[model samples]
Target: MANTTSAKKATRKIARRTEVNKSRRSRVRGFIRKVEEAIASGDQALAQAALKAAQPELMRAATKGVLHANTASRKVSRLASRVKSLSA
Candidate 1:
């Protein structure tokens, strides 16, 4: 129940921002999933490529406030390690 005009506008803004953030989060997850799938398939080359592509996307999400800096870094590190292990 937004009574004031500003409140109504704010509510709308929040709705729009929520949609954008949701999309960004989903996109980041999709990228991560690609890397994981590649790794699981035991294709080291594909996994490495996917990780290369996902790294920037993950950082972008963090920069846009969709994820925390440390969270994104941790994810990148874990994924990278997994990709590395795939080669061994």
Candidate 2:
């Protein structure tokens, strides 16, 4: 119940932003999942390649405000470690 016109417009803007954020979040998750799947498959080359692709996407999401910078960096670090261990 947005009583004012400005409130109504703000509500619409929030809804639009929510949808955009959801899409961005889902895209970031997909990239992370690809890396995880590659690691699970025990393909070091594949995991490395996937991480290469995912790192930028994760950082982009952070820049877009969909993820925290530290969170993205941590995810990248953990995934890189797992990928590295695949060769061990």
- Top model number, lDDT: 1
TM-score of 1: 0.98
Global lDDT of model 2: 0.96
How high a TM-score does candidate 2 get? 0.97
lDDT tens per residue, model 1, 28-86: 99999999999989999999999999999999999999999999999999999999998
For residues 1-88, what per-residue lDDT tens digits would candidate 2 score against the true structure? 9999999999999999999999999999999999999999999999999999999999999999999999999999999999999998
Model 1 lDDT, full chain set: 0.97
Error of 1 at 78 (Å): 0.2
Report residue 72 deviation for candidate 2 (angstroms): 0.5
